[model samples]
Target: MRMPYRVVGGTLVAALLAQLAGCGTLFWPERRGQIEGRVDPVIAVLDAIGLLFYIIPGVIAFGVDIATGAIYLPGGTHAQVDPATLRPAVQPDGTVNRARLQAILQQQLGRHLPLDDPRLIEHRGSPEQLAAYGLVPAA
Candidate 1:
Protein backbone atom coordinates (compact mmCIF):
# COMPACT_ATOMS: atom_id res chain seq x y z
CA MET A 1 0.00 0.00 0.00
CA ARG A 2 1.17 3.53 -0.82
CA MET A 3 0.42 6.76 1.04
CA PRO A 4 -2.11 9.03 -0.65
CA TYR A 5 -0.73 12.08 -2.47
CA ARG A 6 -2.34 14.48 0.02
CA VAL A 7 -0.96 12.65 3.01
CA VAL A 8 2.59 12.46 1.62
CA GLY A 9 2.53 16.05 0.54
CA GLY A 10 1.12 17.20 3.89
CA THR A 11 3.78 15.32 5.76
CA LEU A 12 6.53 16.80 3.63
CA VAL A 13 5.09 20.27 4.02
CA ALA A 14 4.86 19.89 7.77
CA ALA A 15 8.45 18.75 7.99
CA LEU A 16 9.61 21.65 5.86
CA LEU A 17 7.68 24.10 7.99
CA ALA A 18 9.30 22.70 11.09
CA GLN A 19 12.76 23.17 9.54
CA LEU A 20 11.94 26.68 8.50
CA ALA A 21 10.65 27.60 11.94
CA GLY A 22 14.22 27.60 13.24
CA CYS A 23 14.86 31.12 11.98
CA GLY A 24 17.97 33.12 12.68
CA THR A 25 16.57 34.61 15.87
CA LEU A 26 15.91 31.15 17.29
CA PHE A 27 19.40 30.04 16.29
CA TRP A 28 21.35 33.17 17.22
CA PRO A 29 19.60 35.30 19.77
CA GLU A 30 22.93 36.76 20.86
CA ARG A 31 23.42 38.29 17.39
CA ARG A 32 20.40 40.57 17.73
CA GLY A 33 20.85 44.34 17.27
CA GLN A 34 23.80 43.81 14.94
CA ILE A 35 22.17 45.52 12.01
CA GLU A 36 25.20 46.81 10.15
CA GLY A 37 27.38 43.79 10.61
CA ARG A 38 28.22 41.01 8.15
CA VAL A 39 25.52 38.46 7.49
CA ASP A 40 26.13 35.00 8.90
CA PRO A 41 26.54 32.81 5.84
CA VAL A 42 25.21 29.71 7.56
CA ILE A 43 21.93 31.38 8.42
CA ALA A 44 21.73 32.97 5.01
CA VAL A 45 22.08 29.61 3.28
CA LEU A 46 19.58 28.00 5.60
CA ASP A 47 17.06 30.72 4.89
CA ALA A 48 17.72 30.37 1.20
CA ILE A 49 16.95 26.65 1.39
CA GLY A 50 13.47 27.57 2.57
CA LEU A 51 12.97 29.28 -0.76
CA LEU A 52 13.25 25.91 -2.48
CA PHE A 53 10.26 24.60 -0.48
CA TYR A 54 8.06 27.72 -0.50
CA ILE A 55 8.69 31.28 -1.59
CA ILE A 56 6.61 33.18 0.95
CA PRO A 57 7.75 31.45 4.12
CA GLY A 58 11.37 31.65 2.94
CA VAL A 59 11.07 35.37 2.26
CA ILE A 60 9.41 35.84 5.62
CA ALA A 61 12.21 34.02 7.36
CA PHE A 62 14.73 36.25 5.66
CA GLY A 63 12.72 39.33 6.54
CA VAL A 64 12.44 38.36 10.20
CA ASP A 65 16.13 37.58 10.45
CA ILE A 66 17.16 40.83 8.81
CA ALA A 67 14.69 43.03 10.67
CA THR A 68 15.56 41.59 14.07
CA GLY A 69 19.26 41.74 13.12
CA ALA A 70 19.69 38.10 14.06
CA ILE A 71 21.24 37.27 10.67
CA TYR A 72 24.24 39.51 11.24
CA LEU A 73 27.57 38.38 12.64
CA PRO A 74 28.15 39.74 16.14
CA GLY A 75 30.93 42.18 17.14
CA GLY A 76 31.73 43.85 13.86
CA THR A 77 30.28 47.35 13.63
CA HIS A 78 27.97 46.27 16.44
CA ALA A 79 30.68 46.70 19.06
CA GLN A 80 30.07 49.99 20.86
CA VAL A 81 32.53 51.97 22.97
CA ASP A 82 31.23 54.41 25.55
CA PRO A 83 32.31 57.98 24.86
CA ALA A 84 31.96 58.92 28.52
CA THR A 85 34.86 56.63 29.42
CA LEU A 86 37.23 58.64 27.21
CA ARG A 87 35.87 62.12 28.01
CA PRO A 88 38.48 62.73 30.69
CA ALA A 89 41.25 62.56 28.09
CA VAL A 90 40.01 65.50 26.04
CA GLN A 91 41.87 68.64 27.07
CA PRO A 92 40.62 72.25 26.99
CA ASP A 93 43.11 72.86 24.18
CA GLY A 94 41.03 70.64 21.87
CA THR A 95 43.66 67.92 21.94
CA VAL A 96 43.86 64.49 23.52
CA ASN A 97 45.96 64.25 26.65
CA ARG A 98 47.60 60.98 25.65
CA ALA A 99 49.38 60.39 28.95
CA ARG A 100 46.25 60.92 30.97
CA LEU A 101 44.15 58.90 28.54
CA GLN A 102 46.62 56.05 28.60
CA ALA A 103 46.68 56.01 32.37
CA ILE A 104 42.91 56.07 32.57
CA LEU A 105 42.57 53.31 29.99
CA GLN A 106 45.15 51.23 31.81
CA GLN A 107 43.25 51.54 35.07
CA GLN A 108 39.88 50.84 33.51
CA LEU A 109 40.79 48.24 30.90
CA GLY A 110 43.73 46.65 32.68
CA ARG A 111 45.94 47.09 29.64
CA HIS A 112 48.51 49.65 28.51
CA LEU A 113 47.53 51.80 25.55
CA PRO A 114 50.30 52.58 23.10
CA LEU A 115 49.80 56.32 22.85
CA ASP A 116 52.66 56.78 20.39
CA ASP A 117 51.67 53.88 18.16
CA PRO A 118 51.44 54.88 14.50
CA ARG A 119 48.50 52.51 14.02
CA LEU A 120 46.41 54.70 16.31
CA ILE A 121 44.66 57.25 14.15
CA GLU A 122 43.18 60.55 15.24
CA HIS A 123 40.27 61.72 13.10
CA ARG A 124 39.47 65.40 13.31
CA GLY A 125 36.02 65.79 11.85
CA SER A 126 34.77 68.89 10.06
CA PRO A 127 32.67 71.33 12.07
CA GLU A 128 29.70 70.70 9.79
CA GLN A 129 29.94 66.95 10.30
CA LEU A 130 30.21 67.45 14.03
CA ALA A 131 27.16 69.69 13.96
CA ALA A 132 25.20 67.08 12.07
CA TYR A 133 25.82 64.63 14.90
CA GLY A 134 24.84 67.33 17.46
CA LEU A 135 28.43 67.56 18.63
CA VAL A 136 30.41 70.78 19.07
CA PRO A 137 34.14 70.81 18.59
CA ALA A 138 36.01 72.43 21.47
CA ALA A 139 37.07 75.95 20.58
Candidate 2:
Protein backbone atom coordinates (compact mmCIF):
# COMPACT_ATOMS: atom_id res chain seq x y z
CA MET A 1 0.00 0.00 0.00
CA ARG A 2 1.08 3.59 0.71
CA MET A 3 3.50 2.42 3.42
CA PRO A 4 5.34 0.14 0.98
CA TYR A 5 5.77 2.92 -1.59
CA ARG A 6 6.90 5.34 1.13
CA VAL A 7 9.62 2.96 2.29
CA VAL A 8 10.83 2.36 -1.26
CA GLY A 9 11.01 6.08 -2.00
CA GLY A 10 12.94 6.75 1.22
CA THR A 11 15.42 3.94 0.49
CA LEU A 12 16.15 5.34 -2.98
CA VAL A 13 16.77 8.84 -1.58
CA ALA A 14 19.08 7.55 1.14
CA ALA A 15 21.06 5.44 -1.32
CA LEU A 16 21.61 8.43 -3.63
CA LEU A 17 22.75 10.59 -0.73
CA ALA A 18 25.14 7.89 0.49
CA GLN A 19 26.82 7.77 -2.92
CA LEU A 20 27.12 11.56 -3.09
CA ALA A 21 28.84 11.73 0.30
CA GLY A 22 31.46 9.06 -0.56
CA CYS A 23 30.14 6.45 1.76
CA GLY A 24 30.28 2.62 1.60
CA THR A 25 33.41 0.45 1.50
CA LEU A 26 35.79 -0.63 -1.29
CA PHE A 27 37.81 2.03 -3.09
CA TRP A 28 37.54 5.44 -1.34
CA PRO A 29 35.89 4.14 1.80
CA GLU A 30 36.66 7.29 3.67
CA ARG A 31 36.85 6.40 7.37
CA ARG A 32 35.63 9.91 7.41
CA GLY A 33 35.39 12.53 4.70
CA GLN A 34 38.00 14.59 6.48
CA ILE A 35 39.40 17.91 5.38
CA GLU A 36 42.64 19.06 6.96
CA GLY A 37 42.42 16.47 9.74
CA ARG A 38 38.90 17.44 10.75
CA VAL A 39 36.01 15.36 9.47
CA ASP A 40 32.87 17.04 8.19
CA PRO A 41 30.11 16.49 10.76
CA VAL A 42 27.53 15.28 8.24
CA ILE A 43 30.14 13.14 6.57
CA ALA A 44 31.29 11.87 9.92
CA VAL A 45 27.80 10.65 10.71
CA LEU A 46 27.44 9.30 7.21
CA ASP A 47 30.76 7.53 7.57
CA ALA A 48 29.57 5.72 10.69
CA ILE A 49 26.47 4.60 8.85
CA GLY A 50 28.62 3.74 5.88
CA LEU A 51 30.77 1.49 8.04
CA LEU A 52 27.70 -0.41 9.14
CA PHE A 53 26.33 -0.61 5.59
CA TYR A 54 29.73 -1.60 4.23
CA ILE A 55 29.37 -5.15 5.56
CA ILE A 56 28.22 -6.05 2.05
CA PRO A 57 31.41 -4.86 0.35
CA GLY A 58 33.49 -5.92 3.31
CA VAL A 59 32.21 -9.46 2.93
CA ILE A 60 32.66 -9.43 -0.83
CA ALA A 61 36.15 -7.99 -0.49
CA PHE A 62 36.95 -10.65 2.06
CA GLY A 63 36.09 -13.32 -0.47
CA VAL A 64 37.99 -11.56 -3.25
CA ASP A 65 40.95 -10.97 -0.94
CA ILE A 66 41.01 -14.62 0.09
CA ALA A 67 40.78 -15.57 -3.57
CA THR A 68 43.45 -13.08 -4.58
CA GLY A 69 45.43 -13.70 -1.37
CA ALA A 70 44.90 -10.24 0.18
CA ILE A 71 45.57 -6.71 -1.09
CA TYR A 72 44.17 -3.31 -0.13
CA LEU A 73 46.53 -0.75 -1.53
CA PRO A 74 45.24 2.80 -1.16
CA GLY A 75 45.98 4.84 -4.25
CA GLY A 76 45.28 8.57 -3.88
CA THR A 77 41.78 8.08 -2.47
CA HIS A 78 43.54 8.71 0.82
CA ALA A 79 43.92 12.04 2.55
CA GLN A 80 47.35 13.51 3.13
CA VAL A 81 47.57 14.57 6.76
CA ASP A 82 50.08 16.53 8.80
CA PRO A 83 49.93 18.13 12.22
CA ALA A 84 50.26 21.92 12.59
CA THR A 85 53.94 22.88 12.69
CA LEU A 86 55.65 25.87 14.25
CA ARG A 87 59.16 27.14 13.46
CA PRO A 88 61.19 30.30 14.02
CA ALA A 89 60.87 32.93 11.30
CA VAL A 90 64.14 34.77 10.94
CA GLN A 91 65.54 36.97 8.16
CA PRO A 92 68.86 38.74 7.44
CA ASP A 93 67.23 42.13 6.60
CA GLY A 94 70.57 43.03 4.86
CA THR A 95 71.15 46.57 6.15
CA VAL A 96 74.64 47.17 7.50
CA ASN A 97 74.53 49.40 10.59
CA ARG A 98 77.66 51.06 9.27
CA ALA A 99 79.00 52.64 12.46
CA ARG A 100 78.13 49.87 14.93
CA LEU A 101 79.03 47.09 12.48
CA GLN A 102 82.36 48.64 11.52
CA ALA A 103 83.21 49.26 15.18
CA ILE A 104 82.55 45.59 16.04
CA LEU A 105 84.35 44.47 12.88
CA GLN A 106 87.41 46.53 13.72
CA GLN A 107 87.35 45.29 17.31
CA GLN A 108 87.23 41.61 16.30
CA LEU A 109 89.78 42.01 13.51
CA GLY A 110 92.09 43.74 16.03
CA ARG A 111 91.97 40.65 18.26
CA HIS A 112 93.53 38.48 15.52
CA LEU A 113 95.91 41.11 14.02
CA PRO A 114 96.63 43.91 16.45
CA LEU A 115 96.90 47.40 14.91
CA ASP A 116 100.01 49.28 16.17
CA ASP A 117 98.38 52.64 17.00
CA PRO A 118 94.74 53.79 17.25
CA ARG A 119 95.80 56.99 15.41
CA LEU A 120 96.98 55.10 12.26
CA ILE A 121 93.61 53.39 12.20
CA GLU A 122 91.85 56.78 11.73
CA HIS A 123 93.88 57.66 8.61
CA ARG A 124 93.95 54.09 7.33
CA GLY A 125 95.71 53.36 3.97
CA SER A 126 97.31 56.86 3.84
CA PRO A 127 101.09 56.90 3.01
CA GLU A 128 101.65 58.58 6.38
CA GLN A 129 99.73 55.75 8.15
CA LEU A 130 101.87 53.11 6.31
CA ALA A 131 105.13 55.05 7.07
CA ALA A 132 104.22 55.57 10.74
CA TYR A 133 103.17 51.94 11.07
CA GLY A 134 106.47 50.86 9.39
CA LEU A 135 104.73 48.77 6.66
CA VAL A 136 105.49 50.46 3.29
CA PRO A 137 108.72 52.52 3.90
CA ALA A 138 110.17 50.13 6.52
CA ALA A 139 109.33 46.75 4.89
Using lDDT as the measure, the top candidate is: 1
* Candidate 2 lDDT, 1-139, residue by residue in tens: 8999999889867865664454323333532222122223443454445445555633444443323322323234432222111001111332224444444445544422222323222222555744443334322
What lDDT does the true structure give each of the candidates?
0.73, 0.38
* Cα lDDT for residue 33, candidate 1: 53
Poorest 10 consecutive residues by lDDT, candidate 1 = 75-84
User: TM-scores of all models?
Assistant: 0.49, 0.23
Candidate number achieving the greatest TM-score relative to the actual structure: 1
- At residue 83, candidate 2 shows an lDDT of 14
**Where does candidate 1 stray beyond 4 Å?**
1-7, 76-139
List CA RMSD, all candidates: 10.1, 25.9
Per-residue lDDT tens digits of candidate 1, residues 88-107? Answer: 77665456788988887788
RMSD (Cα, Å) of candidate 2? Answer: 25.9
